[model samples]
Target: MTTAYYTHADCKRHEMGSWHPESPERLQAIEDQLIASRINTLLDYREAPAALESDLARVHTADAIYRIRENCPSERSEYDHFPLDADTSLNAYTWRASLRAAGAAVAATDAVIDAEIENAFCAIRPPGHHATSKEAMGFCMFNNVAVAAKHALEVRGLQRVAIVDFDVHHGNGTEEIFNGDQRVLMVSFFQHPYYPYSGTEHPASNMVNVPVPAHSYGNVIRELVSERWLPALEAFKPEMIFISAGFDAHREDDMGQLGLVEADYAWITQQIMRVAKTHSHGRIVSCLEGGYNLSALARSVTAHVKILADLE
Candidate 1:
């Protein structure tokens, strides 16, 4: 079976502002790199559908959903920003694109569950690791991975699902949604004293949060995963795995100081693949989170997707 690649053009239509780091160009970067690397030829491409309100309600409250929907402007020239905390902004196409981005996760989950594909990667954006159930923050509208995880358990009747977040920033939103849910295991590594800086203290039992120092190298991350993530993941014996795949830790990306290179991302993907192979029957679904610098983001994602597509 081939890996499924899920994306939509409407994802490119969602924009916060001209100067926002989480720009539409991020998706274009990954698409261009995948095409140039000939990696697109290795996978099955699928169009992402817009998520229904019920699907979104699995992770976010109806009121929060209504607020986001109400905030989306009707025209591009019109400006109405609904502040979900401080950083996240809702523009004209934000609601539709957010639905499509979340929909990509649901579609990917469905593909993997039905064995239509062994794995899937969602290359959409306004990344979603930061939006919690009641609020949105850090460039996220709805929690895409959380919604997928919820679907895997509630809809697919899976006993266990694991979410591995390798974003430079903490997946606080995901943790908030799944903190007490025993059916889910979340293992993540992020730079401490960074944006949304709360992962370092009083984390939930189900969360394996490794808050590494800034300027740390890939070796540090590798060691943390080896010591913390693998053991917990093996013990959990998850039936499927989800990845919040973020590449901002790359040395060239100014978003974070962690000195990760492209090979580091490839190595992490290989490690996750091993776990998936051994426990989850190679069932893995990955969604994009954060990566700002165009060149570094594209190159790092190329490396990550090469392994996900089994092209490497």
Candidate 2:
């Protein structure tokens, strides 16, 4: 039950602003809790490497990659920012950090496939689920999990893969990238009418998108997983599984209206693990996505990692 913990120092150096919710402190908070919970010692630590341009090409368009690289801000005393949108920005360190974020996912995928570890959790920032193939927005630079899924298929020669996104926001970027691709089966439950609101329309047959209303509780998510996600996953029998593991739905977090707690996250992880063990050889790679409230994010991540590590 070895679980690799993938992260990089560059992740903390990428910041939108002092007041932004997606601050660097989010990673530190998870680190503090893992120590407090004594779960840090039970895991294997790995530094995330930089992703190659070819890896980015698998999911992101060349124009998108060129935009991110060319728009990198030069070093300055006051630190300049290139705003991708109203809520997302790119600082000087963003290019390096974005590479690390995507790299962590790819490295974790390789590790799992090679059986270096049963699974891995990527503690990265500049959360990536919202970035589409042609653009970077919603605090995301590149679609990290998508790159990993593609790497698994193209490089590792996997026939099929499953991406499970539990983020509060709909993974419009992920859905957009893998929309008509039959090799990838993406299942997710996101708050409807939410930010980047776009998951409720006619999705591809390979997608199982369950859009729930705001204020939906943990029970609703559990039921959706049982009836929607599990059936598709079982039928697909993915060769590998990737999770856009966002904890913003925690009841204590104000980022979203969904009322999910730590125990609920644990239950969800258990279900994913069950399916992974049965179909995917217990191979899982989870990358960070969203979760604003520091305390809730830390505690929720601890719970989720505990299940992945088989600690509890």
Candidate 3:
């Protein structure tokens, strides 16, 4: 089985604004880099499906879903200014694009769980680690990774699932959704004193949050994951693994100051793959999160996915 790459054209249509860092060009940049690097030749590509309402309802409340739908613009001009938060906005196509992004995660989950693919990477946009159970914040509309974890447990009958978030910002939404749930173990690393800053304080028991200082190098991240994340993950013995794969932590990205390079992402991917191979039969599903600097994000993701595809 090969690595599955899932994306959709609708994802590019959901634009926050022309100036937003999470632009539609983000997807094009990654895809262009993958094509240029010959990484596209090593993977099986699939178009993402639109998420079913029932599937999204698994993680987000019905009211939240209804609010998003109600807020959707009827026409392109109607959504000149639809705001979820100060940073997050919605346009006419935002709802459909969000559904497709979330659906990519669900489909990737199904592929891994059914053994049709050893692993998968969702090259989707309007990234989803920050959207909580009811609120959409931090450029996220729905918790895509959270929905996949819930589906794996509720539908696939998986006893335990682990979510590893390597985003520059904390996955407060995902943590809020799965906190105290014994079946889920969440390991995350984010730059402290950053955007949506509330991860360092009281955290859930199942959450292993390691806040790295600004300008810290990849060695610090490697040490933290080795000491804190791996031990907890080993003890949890998750039946499946999910990755909230964000590449904004790269040194070239202006979003955060953690000094991670492409090789660092590749190393982390190998570590996660080691855990998946040992405990979960190599079932790993990775969904995109935050990655800004076009060249760095594309290069880092290529390094990350190449490892996931076992090309290196």
Among all candidates shown, the one with the greatest lDDT:
2
Using all chains and alpha carbons, the TM-scores for the candidates as numbered come to 0.97, 0.99, 0.98
lDDT of 2 by residue, 185-292 (tens): 999999989998899999999889999999999999999999999999999999999999999999889989999999999999999999999999999999999999
Candidate 2 at 306: error in angstroms?
0.1
> lDDT tens string, model 3, 215-264?
98999999998999999988998899999999988999999988999999
lDDT tens digits, residue span 1-312, model 1: 588889999899888778889999999988899899987888799999999899999999989899999877777554655556556787778888999999999999998999999999999877999999998889998999999999999999999999999999999999999987899999999999898888888887899999999999989988998899999999999999999999999999899999999999999899899999999999999999999999999999889888987888
Candidate 2 weakest ten by summed lDDT: 71-80
| lDDT against the true structure, each candidate | 0.91, 0.95, 0.91
The reply for model 3, stretches above 4 Å from the true place, is: 76-79
Count of backbone clashes for each model?
Answer: 0, 0, 0
Number of the candidate with higher lDDT, 2 or 3: 2
Candidate 3: 10-residue stretch with minimal lDDT: 72-81
Better of 1 and 2 by lDDT: 2
Segments in model 2 whose C-alpha atoms lie over 4 Å from true places = none
**Weakest ten-residue segment in model 1 by summed lDDT:** 76-85
Q: Which pairs of residues collide in candidate 1?
A: none
What ranking emerges by TM-score with the best candidate at the front? 2, 3, 1
